[model samples]
Target chain A: MLAPLLAVLGACSQSDESITEQTKSAVTQTTTVTADGPPRLEDGSVNLGPPPGSMGFWTANNGRLVNDPNNYEAARREMNSRVNIEDAPLQPWTLALTNYRQDTFIASEPYTRCKPAGGPRQIMSPYGFEIVQMPEMERVYILTVSNAMSYRTIYMDGREHPAEILRPTYLGHSIGHWEGDTLVIDTVGFSERSWTNRDGLPTTDKLHLTERLTRSSLNDMDYTFTIDDPGAYTAPWTSGFGVEWNADQEVFEYMCQENNISPAAMVGEGRLSIIVP
Target chain B: MKKQYIQCRLITVTAVLAAFYAPYVLAHHPVSAKFDTTQSVTLTGRVTEVDWANPHTHIFMSVEDKSGAVKNWAIELESPIELEWGGWRPDTLAIGAVITVEGPLARNGTGQIWANSIIKEDGNSVFDLPDNILESQLGSRVEGPAPRWPDGHPRLGSEPGQSGYWSVPSQHSLVESGVSVAMDKHGILANIEDAASVAPFQDWARDLYVIRQQNFMKDDPLFLYCIPPGGPRMFQVPYGVQFLEQPIHQRVTVLMGGGNSNWRLIHLDGREQIGQVTGNDNNPLFFGRGLGRWEGDSFVVDSNGFNESFWFSNGGLPHTSQLHLIERFTRVDLNTLQYEVTIDDPGAYTREWKSAWTLLWVANKDLPDHYCQDNRP
Candidate 1:
C-alpha cells in the first residue's frame, strides 16, 4: 500500500510539500495527513491531491464517512471508525425509507440502473470522480465513472442560478466560491431520480447541498458537507468525508449494461444495524 | 482475462468487490423484431402527420400503390433532436409536402419503412442517415459561425464550445463538383468500408449481425427506445455533437444534442478504474465505462464493458462483453472535429477495426429540446 501511495505522490508533478512530510512509520494509524493541510503551489492554490493535469487513485477511502459498507468491517479493526454512525441522526422519513430498502432487500440503487447518483451522492459514488479546477473560466467539473458518462458543472464565475422556470436534471445546477484555501460549493435544482447511496438514503428537489473542500494534507482533502432540505429532514445534518490523493491512478470507463448479470449468489445481503433482540 | 473477471466471479470474490449482479430490468427492447432489414421498399406520398417525439421521429403519409390504392404509411426517422442539429426546423417538412422515402419494410406488414432517406418533390433530400462510406476532406466541409471564442474553440452563437450545429454531407457518393444532390439534414452511415467491419465474428454473432442488417435495423434496441447512446455510438449521431471543457474540475463533457438531449462526462482526473481493483465489482455498463485524457489537442477516451442490449454502430454490429473502444476527438480546425474510433472485441469480431469521419460544426444554434416519448399508445 505504501509503495503505491509513494509511487502516486512521486508521479504527481504538483504534489503538495506536506505529502513528502508524511510520517513514514505511522503505519498502524490510518490517520495519515496532519492537521496543518497541504502546502500551496506557486500559483497559491493549495496542492490538493492531484493537480488538474494529474490522476487521483482513491480506494482506501470511501465516498462518505458514514454508511460505507467497507467501513462496517473497518469498525471491527478501528474502534473509532466513522461508520460507527450506523445510528446517526437522520430525519424520520429518511431513516424509514432507508430501513425499508434493507428490510425488503430491494437492490435498487442509482448505480444499479447506471444513473447519476445525483446531488452530494455523486461524491460518495464508488465509481470515483476527477476534479478539474479552472479558475480562469470560473467553473469546475466533477466527472464521474458511470456509463451515462454524466458530469456536474459548478459555476465559479459569480453568476446566479437560473430561475425556477428552468428544467431540473440529474445533476442540479451548482456554483462555487473560494474561502481562502478552501473551495465552497452550493448546489441546487436536482431531478430526484437517484438515491444517495446503496443504503437507499433518499433526497428531493428541495435538497440544498453545501460542500467545503479543503486540503487537509498533501494527499488528503477534508470534505465537509451539509445537507439542508426541509422536505427530507427536520434540520440540516452535517458530515465529514475524507478523500485521499492517489497520484498513480486514472479514472476508467464504466458501462452499466454490459456483463451486468448480477448473480444472487454474489449479491449477498447488507449488514443492517437494527437490533432484533 | 475477462474484463478482470467481475462478470464471472463467485460469491466470496463478489463480496470482496461489494458489487453484485441481479436480473437487470431491460431498459431497451429489440427493434429487429418489428422491422425487416432484408426487405426494403420505396414510398412516395403526401405528408399527413408528423409525431416529432423522442426515441424516434415518425412521419405519417398517404402513398399510392401500384394498383392506384392509397396506403397510409408510417415512416420512422431519427430523433427530432438529431434533425434540429442537422439544420432542420420544425417546419422544414410541413404537412402536405410530397415526400419520397426508402428503407426496410416493417416486419408486421405495416405500410411503413424505418426511413433511411427521404427526398422532397423539389429534389431536396430531407433525411440522410447512416453515412460516412469513405473519407475525403476536400469533399465535405460545413463551416461554423462568424466568430470564435477567446479560447480557440468554436463558439455557437454565445456558447463557447459550440461554434455551430453540424450539417450532414449532401451526397454519400463521389459526384461531379458542379452537380448538387438533395440533402435533408440527416445523419450518415459513415461505416461502410472493411476497416469498419464487425467481422471475425463468431458464427452466432455473424448471423446476428446479418439478420439485424437484413432486417433494416428494425430490431435495434435504440429503435425500441431512445436510451442513451453509449460509447462511440453517442458520437456517431447524425445531428453532430459538441465538447465543453470545464477547467475547474479537469473534466470534458460531450453534450449529445441528437435525440436524447443526453451528455457523456469525460474525467480528466486520473482516478483508478473500478474493475482493476481486487474484490471490486467493475460494474458492467451501457456506455463504455469511460475515462478521458488529453494527448496534444486531441481528447482520447478509453471505455469498455458494453451490455449486449444495444448496437454500437449504425449497421447493428454485434459485440460481446469483451468490447473495448478507444475514441479520439480532435478539433482539427474551427469547422472540423476529427472523430475516430478503434474497436477491439475478440469475442465478436475476428480482428480489431478502425473508422474515421469528420463532424461539421453547425453555427448559430445550440441543441433544442428533443425528448424521446415513452410507449406511444
Candidate 2:
C-alpha cells in the first residue's frame, strides 16, 4: 500500500513541476509583473475559483479582438488587443461591415437590445465572470454577470459537437479539454444574429472558434482565441488579451431584458452623422 | 505490465484520497453562514413596521434597552411564502403590537436577528400553521432507499450510468397545500370563485389574478417577453426541472426545461448573501439568490431577492422584491423527488402560505428540447 501511494505521489509531483515551469516561462515572456502563483487543484491544475477563504471573479474591460491603431479613438479605448486588424485577414465584405458598424458607434448592436452575447463576446462583455469547473459531471460552466446573465456549458468529457443543431443558439456548442494548465475550448454552431465582437464583427453560420484560457497568476488570466470562418474572413486569425481577477467579488444578478430602452432609442442619429450633413 | 500496474495503483491511491475528504465534506454545514447560530438573543418590543417583501420579511420593532432608549431592531423571518404556511397574516402583527422574538443574531453585528419563534403579548405564537398542512404526495409512494453520493449524502442528480430529470409533478397549479382547488393544466381556474382557495392573496393581487383568469392569461409576461418561470412556477411549467449537483463546487444548478431554457443556482457553500447589480445597473432577479443546506436526507433551499416581472407561481400569482422562499427537495426514492415550498410575501398575500408537490424522475431520457420562444404567440 505504501509503495503504491508513493508511486502515485511521485507521478503527481512531476506533473505539478511541469505545470509550474511552463506557467513561469509564459509569464516571463509576456510581462515583468511578478505572479503571486494561482491556487492549484489537488492535481496541480490552476484553480480558477476563489482560493479557499477568498472569493473573486474574472473581469475584462476591453473585449476587443483586434488592435487597429488607425481605428477611432473611442473604439481603441475599449479594446485591448494582441493583433492588429490589418493582419486579421478580413475579407472585403466583412471589412466593409466592420467599418460601417464602427462608424455608427455600434448603436444597433443586438446585445444592447438584450440579445444573448455569443462566441468570443461572452468573455468580452465584462462586469465579472466565473469559470465553474465541475468534474463530477464532466461539465464546465462559464457564467457571465452582465448582458443577459448568460451562461454556457462546455462539455469536458470527450463528447463531440452534435452533427446537426436544429436551431443555432446564441451561445453555440462548446467542448473543452486541458493542455497542461490551460483550458482549451472549441466552439461551433452559433446564431447569425449575435456578433462575435463588441465592435460589430460579423460571423457566418460557419464560425468555428478555438479559445485558450490560462490562469497565469492569482491576479491574471490569459485569454486567446483563433477564429476560423470561411463565410466571414479570408483566413483564420488569432488574437487575445489578459483578463484581471477581481478578488472578493461574485457573479451578481443582471437582468438585461428588464426595462431595456436601447433597442427603441438607438437610431444612429438619423444617418446624417455618417452622410456629413 | 508496468503501465497497467501503475493504473491499478493510481485507482487505489485515488480511492484512499477520496475517503480522507469524505468525512470533512459531509460534516460541513455552511448553510447558516450569514448568521452566527451560536449566539442566541431574545428581545421583546412593539412592532414598528412589517416590510412584507419577497427575499425576506423584516419586522422592525422598537425596543427599549436597559438604558430606556428605544432602538429599532430588524427581526427577519422566513419568506412570505413560508410565513403564510406558518399561519402568518399580513396584518398578523400590526403596527404597535407588542411581541417577543427569539433567534440567533446576524454575524455582521447589525441590529438584526434571524427569528426562530415569535410570541404576542398575549403569550400566543405569532405563527398559526394549520393542522391540515401536509405533503402533497403523488403516483403512489415508491418505497426504496434513494441513491446517495460516496460521502453518504443523498444524490439530487442522476445516478451513475443513468440519465434522468424530474418532470410531470403531481400538482400542476399552485394551490394551498391542503385546499382542493380545481384548475386546468394551465392553472386556469374552472371556477373563478376558487381563486380565493388557491392562495391567501391580498385584495389587489386577487383582483389582478381574476383579471388574468378572465382574459385567459393573454397578458402573461411569460408569454409576452419569454421571461423565465421564476419562484415555484418553474416546477408548475410543462417540461419539469433538472438538478445538476456539483458537491465539489458546493453548488447546485437547477435547470428548467419548460420556459426559455432557464436555470437557477443554489450555493451550498457558506457564503454571506450580498447585493447584486447588473452591469446595466438593474437590481433584482427572477430566480433570486439561493442558499441551501442538507438537513439529513432533505435539501433545504432558502431563496430571496425576487422582482415582480413574472408571477411567483402559475395562475398569475404576484410577488415583490420582499418575497422569500424556503424550498425543500427530497429524493424519496429512485424515481421520486418530493418538492415543498413555503411562500411568504406580505406584499401580495395577506398571510404566508405553502404548497407541496412531488415530481417523477423520468429515467433514461433527457429534458425535452422545449423553449417558450419556439411556441410563443
Candidate 3:
C-alpha cells in the first residue's frame, strides 16, 4: 500500500514543481513599460500612459513622484502615517507584543510561507490587485498575487450587520454603499490570526476598515482606506493607492498542500506540522 | 432522584432507537417503498434490441404475459465488454430469441427487470459457468485468494501506499485516509525481480501494452464518448471513489469519480453461481461479466471478459480478453474496507501481479447521487 501511495504523491509533487517553474519564467518574461511623459489628472495626480501597448496603466505614490530618489524613506513614512487607523487594530494575535522585535521580522519569509496578512492591510501591498464584480449579487471580489490569495466580498444589499456579532475571519465582513461614482465600504469582524504586513505587524478582531473605491479612468482605479481600532492605535489613520486592470489574467485554484516547502521546514524543527506526507 | 433518573433513561432509549431507524427510513422512503424486493418476477420476452454500452447494457424486449398482453420491458444486463469475454454477444439472442429472466423489479414500478441472469428457451445458460467454462472462455486467468504473513491474513493486491480504513471516528477527514501513492517512474511492476515469470502476452495483448504506454495521459475516445469505464478502472481513476452501504438490504453501491458516474451494486443475496445471459448483437461491448460471493467475512468478486478498448489505469495500463480479476473487499470496521485485487492475464502481464489498498467508509455523509447522463460536460 505504501509503495503505490508514494508513487501517486511523487507524480503530483513533480507537477507542482513544474508549475512553480512555469510561473517564475512567466514573471521574467513580463515587460515593464515606462510612463509616457506624465500626464496630470483632475485630482492633481499624474497618469503614466498604457504599459508597453497594454491597456493597463501605473501611477507612483504621491510623495514619491518628486525628482529626488534619496527622499524615498521620507515619502514612504509620510504615506504610512497618512494611513487611516481609526478602526484598524495594531495586531490581532495576543502573542504579538506591542513593541516591534527585530528577531520577529522574518524578512521575505512571511510572504513565501503563504501566511494570511489579513484583509484591507493586505490590499495595500505593492502587488497588483484585480477586482471582479458580480452585478446580480451586487458584490465585488478582490484578488492579490502574493503567495496567499485573499478575497473579500462586499455586500451592497443595504442590510445591517448581524446584531449578535459574528466570529472574525481573515477577510472580515464588508458592507458597501455607492456614492455617485465612488463605492464606499465598511468592514469589521476580522480574525486576529493575520499579520498587518509582511514584517509581521499584527491586528485584532475588533479592527474596522472603511474603503473608497472609484474607477477614475478606463484602465485605473483609486482606492482609499481608513482604519479604526481603539485597542491597537492612538488615532485613526488613512492611506490611499491606485491599481490598474489586467484583462488577460484570470484566477486559478491554488492548493497550498501540494509540494509545500515551509511546512517541511517547520517539521524539521519539531513544530506541529499538519500536512501528512 | 429516582423519578429524574427514570426520565433520563427513557430519553436515552428514544435517542438510540431513532438513530438506528433513521437509515432504514431514508433508504426506503418514496423510492424503495415502491418496489417489493422479495417479489421475484420472471419475464419471457423476445430480444427486440440491445444497447451495448457502459454504466450497464439495456436489452429492450417485448414480453407477453398470461393474458396475451404484449408489454415492452427493458432488461438491464452486464456491460457488453463483460458479455463478450464471457462468450456472449449482442447478436447471441437475435431478434426473435425467446428467453427467460429472473430478477428484482425496478423501484420505479415500471415493466423493467434488473435481469439477474438470462436463460435460453432450451434451458441452456448463455453465460459461462465457473465449473464448465474453459480457460479460453474465461479470458485472462488471475490467481485466487492467498494467505499472507503476520497472523496469516490474506493479502489484498492494491497498489502499494493506499490508506484509509473502513470505520473512522467522526472527527477524521476522508481526504487523509484516501491518499494514493504514485507509481514508480518505471511503472508499477518495473522493480519485480521475476517479471519474466508473469503471464505471457498474446499479439493483440502486446499491442494494447504499447498503446497504453504511448497514450496514458492523452484523452481517449471513451472519455469523449462519455462512457463510464466500469468496475476496477473506475475505482483507480484520479478522482475520488465512495461506497454507499444499504445495510437493510446488505447491499453496497460503489461510486467513482471517472465520468463522475456509474456504480456497482454488491447484492448479498447468498447466491454463488453466475447468472444466465442474453444479447442481441454478435459482438459484446466493454465492461464484462461480474459475479460476487462472500468468503468468510470478505466479499470476493470475479470479473472477466472485458474489451480492450478501455485503458486499465489512468496511467494507461492495458488488458485484453485474458484480463481476469479476483477482488476481495472486506469491511475492516464500520467505516473502512480493505480492498485487494489480483490481476492475472497472460495476455497482458508477463506474470501475475497483486496490489492492495484500503477504502474508507464515507463517514456520516451520503454518497452524492450523481448520474452521468445529467452532467453538463
Candidate 4:
C-alpha cells in the first residue's frame, strides 16, 4: 500500500543510505520533496522509533497548530487568523474566552507556567519528542523533551478507557491501535486546564481527540485529528499539521520548571504586533 | 510500685509529646558559608521538641552554657525520609530526654548548630548504627538460576512470559562499599566526622556535603522543585523501577516509577559517549550519556557529562559537570539483581568510590504510578 505513495515520490538514485537523508536535504533546499517508504517491524507495522540501532525523533515543522493547515506558518509567527476562526464551531462563551486569551498574547499559557503542554500543545512545544512502541509490554509511550520532560502512556493492549476518570489531568487517558500503516489514537478525560492550540483555542472535560498518525515516508509524518468537545464547541472539527523526522537526533532531558519566571509577570493586553511577511 | 506503671507513664507522656509535636519550616542556606566549621560546639541539653518533616528535621533543645544561663537552641538533622531509613521513629527522641550534641557553631552566634552526632545520657546515639543493623544479604533467598536471553546474555529485565519489575532493593541508599560509616539510606552520615570515611571527597565537596546535611537536605532539588532524581538517586528512591532491554534497538530503557515517570536510555550499540548533542541542541542531560555493553554476564554502562542542577545521589552528594559513573548490572539469581556503581567524578571526589547493592524481583505486578508532582512540597 505504501509502495504506491513511494512511487509518487520519485525513483531512488542511491540505495546506499535511507531515503530520509535525501528527503531532509530536499526539505532544507526547498526543492522538490521526495521520500522513501518508512521502515517497518516484522509484523508490517510502521516502526515509530528509529530503525533498529539508530537514534532519531520527530520534530513538528508546524509549531502553532490550528484548524486550517494552510495558515499554520502565519499563525505560528503572527497569530494570523485566516480560515481557522470561521471553520471552528466554538461556542459563544468559548469564542469570547479565546479572544481574551489571544488578546493577552497567551503569556499566561499553562506551558509558560511550567505545566504540562497537554494535547496538541505537546507536539507544538519547542524541542522534539519520541514515540516508543513496546510490543512485549503492549504499551506505547509518547515522551517529550519539553514541558518538565514528561511522558504520556497509550495502552495498546485492547483496554478501554475507565468509565470514569476520578482525577482529571493533563495528557488524559489515551488508547491507540495500528490501522494498517497508520496509527490511530483516541484520548479523553482532560480537565479544562490547557488550550487546545497555541492560538488559545478552548478545551473542556468533554474534549475527545481522534488522532491519526501516518508516516508516508521515512522523513515525514502526517498528523491529523478531529476534536469533539460539546462543552466548548457546537460541533466537532478537524485540524492537522506535518512533523519532520530528525534522523540524526534523539530526545534528551529538558526540565522547564527550573528558574521559570515568565508566568509570574504575564500581565499584558492587546494582540502582538503582526509581521507582514 | 509496679513496673507496668512506669511503662504506662512513658507511653502516655510519649503520646502527649507526639500530639503536641509541630513541624517548623527552617530557612535553608549554605552551611559552608553560614556556619563556622573550624569551631566546634558541645552542648548537653534536654530534648524540648522534635519536628519530623521534609527538607530537614529539627530538634529544639534547652541548654545551659558555662555561664549557667539556660537558652533554647535549634539543632538541625537530616530529612524525615533519611531518618526513617536510619531506623528513626517519630517517638525515637523522647521529650525531656537529656542528650549531648557535638557540631559546628553558627557564624552569627545564634543558638544553632549543625548537629553532627546526638548521644543520649545512656551513651547511645539516637540512630541505629550501621554495625548494629546487620548488613543486607548478598542476594535474595529465591532459589533458581537467573534467566538468559536467546543471545546467551543474562537478562537484566523481566523474563519472557513474566510480568514484573526490579524493586525493593535490600539497600535503599548508596554508600561506599566496605565503609562502616553509619548513615541513612540517602548516605546522610549519622556522624558528620565520618564524612571523609564514607567517600573520598575533595575538601570543598566535603564541606558542601556537610552544609547540605546541616540544612537537613532542604535544598534537594528533587524535594524542592520536583527535579527528576537524576543519578544513582533513582535506584535509591522508594518507588520501583523497570528496565526494558531492547537488543534490536541496541538500547536499554530504564523507566522510573518515582522520578515523575521519567525514563533514561542507555545505548548498547557501542557508540562513542563524547561530543554528542541532544536534538541539535546542546543540553546537559540529567541521566548523563549512558553507553552500555555486555562484559561477560554483566551489563556494564559507562556514563558521563552530568549537570550540577541535581544531586547524583541522595544526602546531597556534590558532583560537578565532570561526573562520570560506571554502573554494573548482574543478575545474581532468578530473583536477585546485583547493582554496583563506581563514582569517578574528579570534580568532587579525591578518588573513585564504589557502591554495590541488590534489588529483588517483584513478580506479577507492574511499576507503580507515582508522579513527583502529586507529592511535591
Task: For all candidates, state DockQ relative to the true structure.
Answer: 0.06, 0.04, 0.00, 0.11
**For residues A181-210, could you state the per-residue lDDT of candidate 2 as single tens digits?**
899999987767677876678888899999
Total clashing pairs in model 3: 70
Model 3 residue A125 CA deviation (Å) reads 5.7
Tens digit of per-residue lDDT, candidate 4, span B275-348: 24441124566888888999999999998877788877777878888888999999988888888999998988
Task: Candidate 2: give the TM-score of chain A.
Answer: 0.80
Distance from true position, residue B317, model 1, in Å?
A: 2.9
- Each prediction's whole-model lDDT (CA): 0.53, 0.67, 0.44, 0.66
All candidates' TM-scores? 0.55, 0.67, 0.34, 0.69
| lDDT (C-alpha) at residue A166 in model 1 | 34
Per-residue CA lDDT of model 3 for B166-247, tens digit only, reads 2111111101123333332222232233222222445565455445433422334333233445445554432235443333
**Model 2: what TM-score?**
0.67
Question: Candidate 4 at residue B195, lDDT?
Answer: 72
Candidate 3 overall lDDT versus native: 0.44
RMSD per candidate (Å) reads: 15.5, 25.4, 27.2, 13.8
Better of 1 and 2 by DockQ: 1
Index of the highest-DockQ prediction = 4
In model 3, state the lDDT of residue B177: 21
Reference-based lDDT, residue B131, model 1 = 32
